[model samples]
Target: MNKVYHLSSCNTCQKILKELNLPASFETQDIKEEEITKEQLEEMEALAGSYEALFSRRARLYRERELNKKELSEADYKELILDHYTFLKRPVILNNDEIFIGNSKKTVAAAKAAVHG
Candidate 1:
């Protein structure tokens, strides 16, 4: 399955999608419009190895709510992500069994290469 989970309003996400130049068959899921289900999160975790890997500490809520002060467990991460879509890192690309999470230069480059090559 070739899918990209991203926020529609994010400029970075849009830029990455353009850069990816994915085929017409590629599926795009706007996380803001459709919240990610627990089952989907589990599937991502399975490929990503851990929920923490998919979690985004950069979320404004994380800092505003002082979530950084507390120690969050695996379950906490899952719950937070489920409760708020912003808790997830943007532009998560799932290409077959390989998963790429985040907008870092290396991750984006790797994802582009995987889809193009």
Candidate 2:
């Protein structure tokens, strides 16, 4: 599965995607317009190891809800991501069986390598 789960409105996600220069075979999903399906989320979880790995603590809702202070479990993370798009870390790139999550310089760099490799 060569796919990307990203927020089109986010500059970081856009920049990283452009930098990756993915091929036509790659699929891009604008998470804002089309919410990620449970099957898609489950597939990502399978590659990523856990829902918490795919969750974004940086989301505004995370702070607004004071989730930072809470001891959230895997189920909580999964539910939160399903509840709100922002709860998901941006630019989740799936290069075949390998999954990459987030937009950090390191993560983006790795994703670029995977896509271009």
Candidate 3:
């Protein structure tokens, strides 16, 4: 299903969701409210190619935990994201089975074209 995984409390997420101009048929999951399921994450991983691609290295917890100091494998990235919602890159958009990760200008632009056009 086409969806957007986002944190409702994050302004960047809110702004992207708006900017994407998603249709009513496209579901939006607030990761903060309903945590991502293993199957769901795995599906994203399948589309995204790796768990690390979905992980947000910029999260406060990532720095607080000093994960950068350690070498993290794909499994580690998957486990970390499943453990905490913050690990997910904000506004992970899945459209027509094509995944758009993070809030970068290129990603948002791509998602906009995919969803609306």
Candidate 4:
């Protein structure tokens, strides 16, 4: 499966998608428009190892809700991500069995290579 889960309004995601230049075979899912389901998140977690790996602590809601002050568990991470779309990191790309999560330089580079190569 060649799928990219991203937020349409995020600049980083837009830039990455533009850089990737994916073909028609690639599928794009706008998380804001279509919220991620539990099954989808579970699939991602299965490839990513854990929900924590897929969760983004940099979201504005995280700080606004003071989630940083509290200790979060695996379940909390999953719940937060499911409840709010922003809790997820931008641009989660799934290329076959390889899953890339986040917008870091290295992650984006690797994702691009996977799709382009």
How well is each residue in 1-117 modelled by candidate 3, as lDDT tens digits?
A: 889999999999999998888998899999999999999999999999999999999989998999989999999999999999999998889897799999999999999998988
What residue runs in model 3 are displaced by over 4 Å at the alpha carbon?
Answer: none
Per-residue lDDT, model 3, residue 24, is 89
As for candidate 4, its clashing pairs are none
Among the numbered candidates, top lDDT falls to: 1
* Regions of candidate 4 where Cα sits further than 4 Å from its true position: none
Off by over 4 Å in 1: none
RMSD of 4: 0.7
What 10-residue stretch in candidate 1 is worst by lDDT? 18-27
lDDT at residue 58 of model 4 (Cα atoms): 93
Residue 63 local lDDT, model 1: 95
Provide TM-scores for the models: 0.98, 0.97, 0.98, 0.97
lDDT of 1 at 30: 97
lDDT of 4 at 105: 92
Residue lDDT tens for model 2, 54-85: 99988999999999999999999999999999
Model 1, backbone clash pairs (residues 3+ apart or across chains), number: 0
